[model samples]
Target: MYLKHFGLSELPFRITPDTSFVFANRQHQEALNTLLMALQEGEGFIKITGEVGSGKTLLCRRLLQSLGNEWSTAYLPNPSLDPDTLFLAIAEELGVKDAVGLDHFHLVRRINRALLDVARAKKRVVVCIDEVQAMPLPTLEALRLLSNLETEKRKLVQIVLFGQPELDERLRRPEIRQLLQRITFHCRLQGVEKLEIGNYVEHRLRVGGYRGDALFTPGALRALFRASSGMPRLINILAHKAMLSAFGEGVGRIDVKHIRLASKDTEGAKSLRWFWF
Candidate 1:
């Protein structure tokens, strides 16, 4: 609503996981580099863990887009499926049109064939599962078994899991320890650091097509960092609200008062009043 008022072409502070707005901050860049290197090595199972709103989904999408040609990617954003449904979803993603009603045996057979077909074309297939903590234990075991389908040289299908810290706890179970061991590469993602908050906001603002001077004052920037505690999603929330607060007052630049008002209205941000005072 305030895009024109702020001389922006798009919403700068949206919480959606759009890759175009992906800030190449330290943590995000490190995580992406790690993932790309591991995949290039043809690692079978890779794990990426981060806290909620830490940008795992966005990272996953960015990785998929970066794979370019020579790689076929399948994304499962929701990992709550049962073992049977999970297999069916993989099969469908691999181009098996009739994956819905197939039995477990048929589903596995189809997925295996699909993987081999992709490999024959000299292209690697990667399956990315998001929110993997919600996947059933049986489904995870099935996933491990699926990873076993491979040629003598390298695995036919590689899997990358993006999830919250609970996924690490889930991997500690006795039944799932084997799966944990299969993770050839693992990376943990952290939120934006305080010192990088200004760059982060400016980066997104530039991506959103703002060519004007600094939109947020120094005091507002400090308040924003303290209020969000370095978390990306929270920063977006607070920043968006602060911009709205500024727009309401017919101001172009966000000030400390606007951030304080935004923080007061946000759930976790209220405790940041100490920062304001």
Candidate 2:
């Protein structure tokens, strides 16, 4: 709604994980680097954990986009499937069309054949599972067994897990200890630091095609950082609402008052203790 008023080509704060709007903030860049290195090393399992709204999905998308053609990627955005269905999903992703009607044991063979075909092409296969905390424990063990498929040289497929902290708790369970042990690399995503909030806002604004002068005043930026607690999603929500409030008042710049109102209006940011004042 404030695009024209702010001289922006599009809404900069949409929650969708668009890689084009990805900001290479320190945490994100490092996560991507770690993923690349682990995958290159042919590591069997990689785990990345972050709090809700900490940009895990965005990082996942950016990593998928950055991977070269040498890597074949299978993405499982929803991990609610049972082990049997999970196998079929991977089969479908790997282009095993005939796996749909096959039984569980037969489906595993089908997937193994597909992986071998991919290996013969000198390409690596990567399976990325998001929200893995929701996946059942049996399915997770199945994933571990699937990871056991390997040639003498390296693993046949690598798995990357993108999830919230609950996934860590799940991994700690005695039944899933083997899967946890197989994870060769791990990275934790954190909120932007206080010092980086300004740059973070400017980065997203520029990436979203804001070409005009500063839209948010210094005081407003500081307010935003406090209100959002440096979480990217909360930052986006507060910033968007702040801009909308400014636009509604026919103002050209956002000030502290606008940020305060924006923070109060946002359900998530309202949980910040100072907002109750």
Candidate 3:
């Protein structure tokens, strides 16, 4: 609503994972580089864990978008499926018929055949599961089995799991410890650090075409770092509200007062008040 008022081409603080607005702050860069390097090494299974709203989904999407033409990706946003259902989801993604009705045996053959077809056509498939913490134990086992698809030289189906810390905890289970051991690469994503908060805000603003001078003052940005605790989602939430607060008063820059007001009105801001991002 305030895009024009702020002379922005798009909403700078949107909650969605728009890769164009991805800020390559230290931790984000490290996480991406870690995953990219691991994938290039033909790792069979990789898991990336982060706190909720810490940009795992965004990173996953960015990875999918940036992958080379030799790569094809199947994304599973909801993984709370039974083993048979999980295969069905993969089959459906690969455009197989009777995905749900087939017995587990048929489902596996179908999925494996489809994957082989893709490989023969020269496209390696990567199955990326988001919120993998919700995946049933058998489903995870099924996923591990899927990773077993490989050519003589390299893996056919590489899996990338992006999820909250709970997913790591889930992988540590006794029954799933074997699956955890199958993970060839793992990376943990940390939130934006306080030093990067202001730059991050500015980067997003510029990406959204905010041509004005600094929209947030030094102190206000510091306060925001605290109130958001370096979490990108919360930072965007606070920054968006701070801008609105400033706009309401017909101002161009956000000060601490504006941040404080924005914090008071924002959910989860209270918990972060004790620590700066």
Best by lDDT: 1
lDDT, model 2, position 220: 81
lDDT of 3 by residue, 149-245 (tens): 7778888788999888899888888987888998988888889998999899999999999998888888888898888889999999988988888
* Candidate 3, poorest ten consecutive residues by summed lDDT: 268-277
lDDT of model 1, residue 12:
87
* Estimated TM-score for each candidate: 0.96, 0.96, 0.94
Q: Which stretches of candidate 1 lie over 4 Å from their true place?
A: none
For candidate 1, write residues 29-125 as lDDT tens digits: 9999999999999999999999888899999999999997999989999999999988888887888887778788888888888888899998999
What are the per-residue Cα lDDT tens digits for candidate 2 across 60-130? 88888889999999999999999999999998899887987888888899899999999999999999999
Error of 1 at 105 (Å): 1.7
Query: Which is the leading candidate under TM-score?
Result: 1
- State the local distance difference test value for candidate 3: 0.86
Flag the better candidate by lDDT, 2 or 3. 2
Give candidate 1's TM-score.
Answer: 0.96
Listed per model in order, the count of residue pairs whose N, CA or C atoms clash below 3 Å is: 0, 0, 2
What TM-score does candidate 3 get on C-alpha atoms? 0.94
